[model samples]
Target: MTACLLPASTTLASVPIRFVEPGEDGSLEGLGDTECAYLEATGFKPTAGRIALLPDESGKLSRVLFGLGPSGATDRNGLLPGKLADLLPAGTYRFENDPDDGALAVLSFALGRYRFDAYKAGRADGQGKDGGDDVRLIVPDWIDAEDVERIAAGISLARDLINTPSNDMGPAELEAAARQLAERHGAAVAVTEGDDLLEAGFPMIHAVGRASHRAPRLIDITWGDPSALKLTLVGKGVCFDTGGLDIKPAAGMLMMKKDMGGAACVLGLASMVMAAKLPVRLRVLVPAVENAVGGNAFRPGDILRSRKGVTVEIGNTDAEGRLVLADALALADEEHPDLLIDMATLTGAARVALGPDLAAFFSRDEALAVEISRQSHAVQDPVWQLPLWQPYEKMLESKAADINNAGSGPFAGAITAGLFLARFVEKSTSWAHFDAYCWNRSSAPGRPEGGEAQAIRALYALIRNRYAA
Candidate 1:
């Protein structure tokens, strides 16, 4: 199921999809007595997510009816209608009463069709047990089909990368994927891997990743004009986190494969920016590694020096994401890029605070924060701004090192993690840090239960308006 956003030239006889709310079926035009009676007899209340197929005189498939539930309940998730891509029978469909935001609904429908069947032993496109042909959505003239396809494709790439198991997606494989994306966009990519990271002054990244057999690496991609506004993106690319010497319980380790979700999301955003040929110079830095446990693993008490020359005490081995991001963010800060952003699955505290559906981000720049907040609302990609509490910096203080990677107290874990990162960044004019839980525990609307792309959509919109304007 590739893009369902077919061109307007698709001449197939399209089916009309009518959205019906509670007690609103009477408003549906051209509904004959038979159809009304059928609905009444069926007790169709038009509750949310309900779908009913109507047949015409000869019992041929006619219009499709999707429910809107009770009033005020329909538009909860802007992309709720995207579920139709997976639920509806394979055919061409168009909405007749789509009173909601048309663009998001349409885009969601396009994104909803994605299914990661790569690991499936013998599945081909449109060849699953319940699938025969593609379910195509007619592109509304008002909607930009190409842009919808572009965004969907980027999100799909991130989902794909994040969904892949660690056994198949180590540091080397992650580098290859980044390289491939760079090559496609004619961007220049440079990689510093293994012991070379030490030689290149990225000690924290090397320290966190050295225990794994697959060598650690920093995948860097640079694109666009030299003199344009410089934008740098840093992502934590821990392929898998074993929690190192302070090993995690089995339950905690179950979803460790998604440790690189931040990298996947940035690459997804990069794909969108590069594909659109945005005007600004863009740089992507991903410190790829696996925090594995072995005799060579950096111990909990170890103090590792960062690329920025700050010594960090390893308070907790599980807090390695911030370490890798620190070195990468430090490198990005050196150029004093106009904008620098780093994202990671850095803390479970963020999830505890905002839940899995919402991501937490920190930004000291008020104007930029306001702009990002606006775009996030405009796009329905929810992200909450958590304060980078200055006072919490003390939580990361260490006697043996400049700062500790993890906090001493249970409070403000997310804020302290942000503060830990802020220590390495100073030159950047505007910077933000995101702590994202890049997986959905349960399927909802356009989001499936597997790996997800968080915050990038809103960030993409912000960048487009800010730089490309």
Candidate 2:
């Protein structure tokens, strides 16, 4: 269930949350002089993540002070207020002054309150440790409370899906989740499962997923008016990649449940778009599968035909994400939508190059890349653009087939993978691929050490601005 962030009453009666910068004491301006002096004498210093409580004349709690690190810090994680959400006692709070980014502060607060106790005992009642806390944020006059709630709801949905264990989050479960989202928004859903994939010409999706006892499926959902601008989204939903016949080491397979993060992310974005009722024909395609190591698994050196009719030689069975995505992307491209986006947890190279915080996206369209970058900075959802590098196309050359599933060299693995997927996309279409690490390594202010949602906010901002009616 999604956590409630905004307060029921819009009137400002809650305690004020004052955000202070390092070496700044002016944030306590409205406080009683004695209370300010007491804070100072008690060794209170303005530093990031530091909080101080204020008391009234009768010694009852009055206001809160939170540190915002040094002023002019370039790399501020907007989720700082989220720390307060976790620490503050059950009560309502309101920012004394408008935050640097009101939307981010609201989002961070809601996200920080998230707890995934789905499988834990006593959680069947839908209550967690933080559930009883009546903590809420008074929506700022300038901020749209509904918009923030919508985006936060989407993020929570993605996190819940990504955090679920593989036992309960198989291909079928994923399809059901998609259906639920579509039904909630009055969208249409169509799923092609099992041998139907072969009949539907999604041979590559079938070839990679045939090994698992659970059937593989392609989840396609559509919403909005057909006459509007077309926006197609494709996500790689590798539910649990056991590396197929090649198999991963135990350490490498630990986080395999998050392999479907791409699928979760697209669904989150779709939710936001549909909720906002953007003037665009939206379609989401997710190739949901588990790459297990059963006897029927496709083996290295085997050739398989894709939906686009391009034959691919399997250089490594572990590189199964690109195979399933190939068929899905091909299907998405057939419509030649005005904007096409595909996101996946596709490569370790992306993590090495950009780390886990910043997602690496590839785009052939310079204008779209620029707009996305602009919005990324505005929203603080970071994404770095990598080149398509036409020269690297040779790295995927295969003598046995039209292309190879894995690149020839170890270097530029991310780029080569992008190049391989680029084969399935039409050159005339405006397409962008995001390689994201959907898991957080450690606990941060608003983000906990678990599955996370990335890149959706900036992309939503871009779409909302472009197709604004």
Candidate 3:
């Protein structure tokens, strides 16, 4: 993890950071005549995310001006100050004005400071030499510094796991990460590994991962009070997806290491829930595997029995994410949790429909869908709801099995995948499925280009609101 939030200090030379709204240059009052004239001469018209450095009379760095766009305009990016973390020079800084949402500003600032330097040279301490930018923010009095740190920690955990390569992050390594998380939170963890999955009734999980040298395992972590509201989260942990017998092209296999992004995301969310001590009994299930091609690899046209007793015909071995998730979701559903949610970097169709910035989620429960949608906008996590559409259920029909792993046609690929997973989940459970790209195609203000954490924040907010302690 990178050193993001810094402690407040009284003696350090602090620069005042001011946010200016468009057409509101008057807000720069009390900055002294010389500084104001310098800003005006430089044509600093308060454009959104634009920054201007101001110097003092002695030619020393003084204050900084950041544009917040317009007053009535909605900032879908949430915190505007996050961009400043990378732009500001190595020094301590303080906010000049009190923003409407102080916590988000500080949280975003910490998020923007993140850098994945794990494999980079000179990172003996995990953070590289450039890590010592020494950029610090004096958090506003109204904002809880602890809360900001907690959220940033969760986000960093997900980013770190996703950014790691497949060589160092196989199924065994993923289980290790979960164990470390469980240890920190005083949670109990049980792992069902290798051939043991067969006896454990996770045949689909076993079949999907039988080819890999690294054994397949289901990571289950439980935390919080036993009597509290039951909240279960399932994540697809395909550590590397070679597409099994149906191998992907060289271009398509580049980002296969991030196939386990869903597991990383759920673990991150679980960390936040446990850290916040949310009044809920949280259960996290990750079906960790590597869909590699070998002699023992399951082939296309093979029939497999799921934990839910539903037989599935393999339409395509490449569509293995849902296979592993199906078993885990069935296990979670058996307990009939109050809320069951599964997230995966499942389909390219989802990316084509909603793009990389937005996540596509599906749910049969209308009220739960509305709440998640509302919270997504509130947190700026950006999720859109797609219907379960029972009519599309026929798309997954098979002559030999109860269902097919993929749809019969290219149309509605993401929807069909959602419907396939829905078969494992009990009808009475309030379940939601997130089909997220989990990778940013390009770098944005607070969001870096590599493995991004989507929907977790919004889902966390929803859980906190529903089970406020």
- Pairs with steric clashes in candidate 1: none
4-78: candidate 1 lDDT, tens digit per residue: 676766787899888877776365679866666666778766678888777777777788888767777735567
By summed lDDT, the worst window of 10 consecutive residues in model 1 runs over 124-133
Worst 10 residues of 3 by lDDT: 124-133
Where in model 3 is the C-alpha error above 4 Å?
7-11, 74-76, 125-133
lDDT of 2 by residue, 76-129 (tens): 568788787777877878888766787798788877877778778767743223
User: Looking at candidate 1, what is the lDDT of residue 152?
Assistant: 82
Q: Each prediction's Cα RMSD?
A: 2.3, 1.9, 1.8
Q: After superposition, how far is residue 186 of candidate 2 from its true place, in Å?
A: 0.3
lDDT of each: 0.87, 0.87, 0.87
The TM-score ranking, best first, is: 3, 2, 1
TM-score of 2: 0.96
- Model 1 Cα shift for residue 102 (angstroms): 1.5
Which residue pairs clash in candidate 3? none
